[model samples]
Target chain A: MNHYIDVRTQIPRARQTINNNNIKTETEGGVPEWAIIELQGLIQMKKEDQSGPTVVGDLHYFSRNRHPVLILGHHVLNGKEVKLEQPMAVIEKDDTTSYKVKAIVKKKLLFKSRPKPIISNVSEKV
Target chain B: MDTCPERSSEDVRKIIKTAKLHESELTEVTQILRFPDPSKQNDNLKLMLLDDNLLKEIEGGNQLIFKGDPDENAVLCTSSKTYDIKEAETSNSLLLVPELLFAASTGLDETIVNKSVEGDSDSSFDKSNTSLNKSADSDDGKPPREIVHKDIISTFFTYYELKPCKPRLSKLIKLLDPTKYRGPELEYAVDKSKLYNYEALFDQIQASKAELDEELIKIQAIKIDDHYRLLEFDYEFRVLSHMLDLIEENSWPLDRISKDVTIDSLKDLVPESILEAMFGFYSSESAVDDGIQYYQYKQDKVCQFLARVLLKSAGKFNLTEFLQAWRDSVPEGMTTDESLLSGIALIDKTTTPQVVWGFAESDLPEDINQRFKVLFQTKAKWTVDEISPYIQLYATEKLNVNALLTKYARASTQDGVRVFSAKHMK
Candidate 1:
């Protein structure tokens, strides 16, 4: 059977590119180039993406400590374009729980000014 | 007119013999015959007459000897008229001679006159010479002067007055020489004793003796434990007991309390833990329960009594009016939902009397009159939470701990949400 897995937990690799006739990995520090590219793509997507209908999905993974973590339902992703409505959950495999986490979402509105009408009747009436 | 004949003849014979004698013999006879009482014609005069006759015979003066005896006892002489013979008795012969002389010559009376003239001549010569000498010396030109008896007496008195009666300063200095005073110490002491009153000097000595006695008494009065004993109990057990009541009434937090709380501050509201600590430490017993029991049962009654006393001493004012007025003036930041909720949370957690006291002393309006104005502000209504930080900042700067506590207590009560209309909130 084909089993589904969370891509967040998978180790990612940098893509090699030719620059000045030399091939080199694009990553800096220990972070993967694909993750940085994805974050930048997401930042750009939020600025340009219009409000529209889209499909949603869920993902699950384990932390380095083998903690049971759950991604909440209904996240929109279109390659570079992604939006989240709720926070992901992290549950340790231990017997006791010490604290809980809550989610927060904020939306800002921008309004445009309408053009004023020309006073063509003023001179004729006067 | 009735002349005696025998006196006259005898006088003639004496003059004839005086004329016959030499000057030297005459002088010798006159000296011998001179009588103190020549007026008596006695037998002594007959002897003088015989000496005069002998002197005349020796000097070779003629002596006509009368041979006719007028009487067998009397000597006789010739008279001018006749050779008269008279028998004169020797007893009465001396008296009859002067009578015979007076009858013989009228010049015999002139002889007494001549004797007075000779006597006055020498005295008059002395008087004139003395007067001439005095006149030549007289400067006043009035007359020859004699010393008046009164002037001589006055001059003697003047000389006595001018005579020195007392010694001079130099003489007194010589008598009291410093070199002599240093010679014998006893003499110096005697002289000094004379200069000062002995009774007063003795009194001074006695006063110094009394002072020494007083000093000894003061030394004896000093006790052994006086130095550090009082310092040991300077803060009494009762002081801690009083502090315990104050801690409970104000709800002071346990962790915040320290022994460093000034006696002046703790006097207002005594803490129970302080009393428990003091009693436990001093009495060597666990006094925690005793302190709690004392506070829970008896301390409240004591505090009420103290509060009544303090209230009586406090100034009179309409508390209702003051509270209402303060409520009205609460700042805008104090009456918001967020500030009010936060204030309530702070008040619930607060354990210290200082925090509660701070709220009680805020200056914000408490009346409903200004409530509408407070509700209109967007930031928040003025409440203790908003004003307290400022009061703490000010009170801390002023270093007034009492004011901080009072303001903290007042502010806690004043914290409340001010509900506003939707239009006003915007």
Candidate 2:
């Protein structure tokens, strides 16, 4: 039996599927910024079967940006590389959904430190 | 209270001292973190966009300014560019925590903590922290600008974006999952080995197949030979039976028997060695010699068989009756005289003589005298010319006996010729 959920109610699951499929993102929500993107726009895919641009719904995309690229001859992010622009569709908290916008790939000269990875469940021996 | 900043001015100073970043490096670090409303900052900017996530270097030394989130992921960024959080805690950029919000929480906390706990003054900590924040946050008052320096920009984008070049799909697929793309690689490895093992195996199989085929052919040939030999034996038996039948049906004359009974003429009846074994009457001195001994051996066998056949048919034989019978038996193409003589010669040693001549000088003389005595009794005296006809009557062939005639007769001159009369006293 196929249990299908409305995409509106299933954004997190949808996002999980996209992340598992290895699409790139630069957004905090872990989604790209475009309504339709060339399937080739995702770094992980070879050329997908369809020739024209694919709507964000058709794409396997996520805001999780672990996709890798070679930049100035170095592997970054635990030997992973990321591409910043890919198409994504995200459902907001109120169930309103937004498609990705076209983003110009530009240099972010003012780089900030990543937040420390925190382990949550340990107690102090007071 | 929810957005608590955990860093202190003393920690920031420590990072600066470890990295040896100059005052300008400190300013760049401070500016990037001090966007009054941190929540409103661009998401792309907040990404750890540099390879080492170090944004810039201060001029005097190895000090580099790095950026990362400190509390959310606990990356613990430091000014030392090569530091990894999982590997070591020492980093020069550790002080530049984005969560610190260089102006509000961490700065004030450092001032209060310094005054209460240690000999360090609140006034001195406030001076450095406030100066760094003022220079950094005052740059736009509008929004934090994207970095403009080429080296800094290039490093950030290189880490964050894919280059605009195509990569080979086959190579890319292999790189993605090596285990699945195994066919070509396995074949290539097998080909590169020097043994040519598959070819060798094929050759061995072919050789074994050829040997089996040869063995099958040999067996077939042996079977054919055995079959042919049996057929030949059967044919010989048939031919011998036919020859024996031909002999029994015909009253073969002596010469006809002689011609037909030779080993060469009757070869179809039986092999030469089998014929010799059956009817041979003489032993040859040398088996190797196709010479006179072998010829005589064959001739003797033929004559013996004929004599035995003739003797069997008629119980007892006399010369006159045998002569008549042999004359009738002579085959065409041979003279009657020659056939009779050869037959007599063959049977002579085995048979008794027919004519008796007692007290004879020789058979020819005794024969002549006997004929004269009989003629003389018929006529008391006769001319020599009258005796010629009677003398020829007993002679089997022409004989010269004119000189012997004087023993039986007396001669006188009468008219112009001579006449002879038998002497009465002798």
Predicted candidate 2 versus true structure: per-residue lDDT over B248-314, tens digit per residue: 4554432233222555556664555434433232223333233323222233333333333344443
DockQ, candidate no. 2: 0.01
Q: Model 2: residues >4 Å from true position, as ranges?
A: A1-126, B1-10, B26-426
Docking class of 1: incorrect
Every candidate's DockQ is: 0.00, 0.01
Question: Candidate 1 chain A, which ten residues in sequence have the lowest lDDT sum?
Answer: A101-110
| Residue range with the least summed lDDT across 10 consecutive positions in model 1 chain B | B151-160
Tell me the alpha-carbon RMSD of every candidate: 78.3, 51.5
Question: Per-candidate interface C-alpha RMSD?
Answer: 99.9, 24.5
